[model samples]
Target: MVKELDPSLNESEFLLEALRKGHRVDGRAVYDMRLIELTFGSDYGHVEIQLGRTRVAARVTAEVVRPRPDKPTEGMLLFNTEISPMASALFDAGSRSEEEVLISRIIEKAMRRSRAIDTEGLCIVAGEKVWSIRVDLHFMDHDGNLIDCACIAAITALLHFRRPDVTVVGEEVTIHPVDQRNPVPLSVHHIPICVTFGFYANGELMVVDPTYLEEQVQEGSMTITMNIHKEICTLSKAGGIPLEMDQVLRCSQVALVKVTDVTEQIQKALADDKVAR
Candidate 1:
């Protein structure tokens, strides 16, 4: 069963009315996301993201390793996180908290579901060896939603990272260092962006990009990751309450509309940066 609203009934009702009237508490439309700012190449393989006050940074590195027995021709992608104490009081440095685990799982699920990276292309000599790419996410701020910000950071960093070329001579494989002359980019087929929305009161009150306060009060939420082709890559719904099929479909419709704009914004940012460089 859906839970009742908190004691702040007036504020909640006001926000709901505002949303019904096509205005959010933050003055954005129901389908609008927060302002996004992206910075690439701050370091060798680093990307920084700013979604409102929430900040996340990711650095990617690669190394050659033996292929897994089950997937001999595919490379591996590992996602790690370092939750600094400065980022939030709820997180302590070097400690694996519940939030950290959820963050990692969400990222892993999104990548696996979307098949964003072309792992098979990383194979050097088939079963002999393959490249393993590691992405490290550093949480600089915890404004509200970590999953959305982290996913954005991860995708942006992967897009900007370049790997050194590899050559196989007989039984031996050689990996070259990245320099101005030889730099290879990762095989990324599509760009996926995640959009999250809060559902309340029999799905009557819906809001996009919920703030921390709204997240705390909401009974249920859904997240959708859509690729450049407008395909649904990942869909996650949580909250003990059960929702009707029509409600689920309605959420997907709203989410797709928002993801279109989000993906375009990210692509535009990347393109603009390339032009500036």
Candidate 2:
């Protein structure tokens, strides 16, 4: 398996030096994140998010399927993430890379395991049929922080998604078209946003929303998933440099602030879209 070439020694040194001096090449403060922009498609449940140069698109779709044998009362929420070579040369066309696997797992834990969606609300008939919601995420651009960008896209799309209304009469189930009946939105419990921090200089210098170059040269990183309600969904750090207790707490504080801002933006965008429609 081939890998993308690493940054030159001189380039890494220059970046590290700038970071140590509390200066970011992108002109952002040490703990500042890049600007986030959300764009919705004409069709419901389709959203595109741009975090600086990183771009991700998410689409939500639902289907009627038999309920699981073990949990007949609950529906399903599935996620599929695709990273093509077009997003970055490091990723291949067909196979899954290590980073891809990590991103998928973290997202699953953050969204599904965290119970952000009320799966039981999707049931059309207990033990008979249920709505299976699937979220498809595509990485259009990969500057850095694909995980955070993908999370934003996923939640926004899910909130924007509307499923066809279903009516169950005795043993028969009837699905209504959107034109004939107003579609029903999913029961989203809370939005879990991901805040990723890049560590440098052996964890002394840290920055939020690291760029592609910064990622390649960073010593380690951590991603904290939080909601606007002050709840933590997940905290992921895959072995690069161990962090102190104080560092973890500080990172969590930063994550909360970022999540609050992002949530407000999402709400405002949704309201604006509703008005437009």
Candidate 3:
């Protein structure tokens, strides 16, 4: 849905003012993200995230299922979405559309590119049975830059999630809950975070973590997901306008700076959880 904008401010005028101030409409530098908060759960695989005004909750649940016909030895990662009507009038609880498809793809891309979750470790009894982990993301709020927030939430949740231990004896596997034993964490290679940048009209402005209003009026938008090693995991472009190669490169550089802060925050959150426990 097209977010409503302030009646008094026109897109051109807003861009001009921001350009003069060396800042964006939201009072953020071109590479700054709004405040971020993350919470980790001790119970295997629960995470809560807050990015500015947007919030997302994720839970990781596992079940033993027959492995895919071709890949009998590896487990699978399934991503699902639930956009309640309460979250936005634009989305209906029962409806599925292109928006949902794109959201799923963005999350999947980040997961696949970052290798955030280790699927091979999930196998038990090989061809006979394997654990399938399902990640469910609930978009509680969508203030702006859902992709970045969602990616962060997904990765954090995966890192925090733990699964019951499985013991195999004579081809028989038994599962033990977290309470019975220390749960096994999903193997993660690296943590990656996403940052979004918006390019507006007049070659006059760029903004990071655009609010819904800014996103609605921007000429073009791009998201860059980067790992701690400074490798680009995913680069996505949305909106109707075209972007130059130089512009894209500039955005990537800015994204790297922004993602560094994001990654630190996530790591801090994880560390804080350990201290609390």
Task: Please provide TM-scores, in order, for all candidate models, with all chains considered together.
Answer: 0.89, 0.98, 0.91
Q: Please give the ranking of all candidate structures by TM-score, highest first, separated by commas.
A: 2, 3, 1
Q: List the residue pairs that clash in candidate 1.
A: none
Model 1 regions more than 4 Å off: 1-22
Off by over 4 Å in 2: 1-3
Model 1, 1-277: lDDT tens digits are: 2333443878878876776787877787776778988888745468888887888999999998999999999999889988887776667667798878877877887775578999999899888899899999999987767778888999888887888898789999877776534668888988777778787766777777787656766778877777657688877775635678887778778777776777777778778877886
TM match of model 2 to true structure: 0.98
Better-scoring candidate (TM-score), 2 or 3:
2
lDDT of each: 0.79, 0.95, 0.79
Of the pair 1 and 2, which is ahead by TM-score?
2
What's the lDDT for residue 40 in model 1? 84
Q: Candidate 1: minimum summed lDDT over ten consecutive residues — where?
A: 1-10
Candidate 2: tens digits of C-alpha lDDT, residues 57-168: 9999999999999999999999999999989889889999899999999999999999999999998899999999999999999999999999999999999999999988
* Candidate 3, residue 36: how far the Cα is off, in Å: 0.1
The residue-by-residue lDDT of candidate 3 on 199-268, one tens digit each, is 7664346788887767766777777888868898888875657877888888888877777788888788
Error of 3 at 151 (Å): 0.6
